[model samples]
Target: MNAPLKITKVGNSAGLILPKEVLAHLNAAVGENLTVVFTTRGIELSAADPDFDQQMAAARDVMARRKRALRELAK
Candidate 1:
């Protein structure tokens, strides 16, 4: 699962080419969008989900507006 990847120049920006085996393991195809997440441990790459992102944004807005209500409900 662990494989070394190299960053090569692509036009102006550098890009890393994922191995075919890695792509197949992740069920990713060429031209498919991927999401990069930075955590305390390290960087993570995963398939992008636009629908999930929208839903999370809506949920965050609701939580921000109803913080007290949610706290009371949790009690």
Candidate 2:
């Protein structure tokens, strides 16, 4: 499942163009956001979870507001 990928210039940033077969295997299309995760082995790419991201943002806001309470509860 290894395919050679080339990094090309896209304005100021560099981008990689995935082959059609790889795109088909990932079920990804143009304009879709992908999440890149860095692991010990290597980098992993997956489709972004918009809903999960939104939920995490909300949780972070709540945690910020309730920092004192959460700290006490953790004791």
Candidate 3:
């Protein structure tokens, strides 16, 4: 599904307006969050995973706290 969206001004911030059909295709709605991942190809957008943020935060904390151990294990 390809959507050609235009960037527009929302108050002071610039954002893209996802058309209703596009949002429906994503199984998303207005005011709902979408996860955007920038891969080598381009930007990928999908419906947000509720626990993704928490899992990422936990992983970051673990990496920070176990930096030395992880580095050694990477050898």
Candidate 4:
């Protein structure tokens, strides 16, 4: 169900008022930063700091592609 949002003042900034249920569902908290991406479809938000599997995969791919160059540089 889409609930109505209340506009409130946060110091000098205006912010959207979210319900407790919504916050609990998202597992977000105050002062936490989320990555928000605006795509052609719509907006998407996720935790910025996720598992390191993707990073490790990227490093492996780069190393595989530049094995010769890296070997030369190591000397």
Please say which candidate is ahead in TM-score: 2 or 4.
2
Candidate 2 C-alpha lDDT tens digits along 1-75: 798999999999999998888777777888888888999999998877769889999999999999999999999
- Residue-wise C-alpha lDDT for candidate 1, range 1-75, written one tens digit per residue: 888999999998999999999788767899998889999999988877869889999999999999999999999
Give the alpha-carbon lDDT of every model. 0.91, 0.89, 0.92, 0.79
**Candidate 3 to native Cα RMSD, angstroms:** 2.3
- Per-residue lDDT tens digits for candidate 4, residues 14-34, read 987667676667788766666
Model 3, 1-75: lDDT tens digits are 686889999899999987888888899998899989999999999999989989999999999999999999999
Q: How far is 16's C-alpha from truth in model 1 (Å)?
A: 0.4
Output the number of the TM-score-best candidate: 2
Clash statistics: count for each candidate? 0, 0, 0, 0
Cα displacement (Å) at residue 28, model 2: 1.5
Candidate 2, clashing residue pairs? none
Residue runs of model 2 more than 4 Å from their true location after superposition: 73-75
Candidate 2 vs candidate 3, lDDT winner: 3
Q: Which number leads on lDDT? A: 3
Taking all chains together, each candidate's TM-score versus the true structure is 0.66, 0.78, 0.72, 0.47
Task: Locate the minimum summed-lDDT window of 10 residues in model 4.
Answer: 44-53
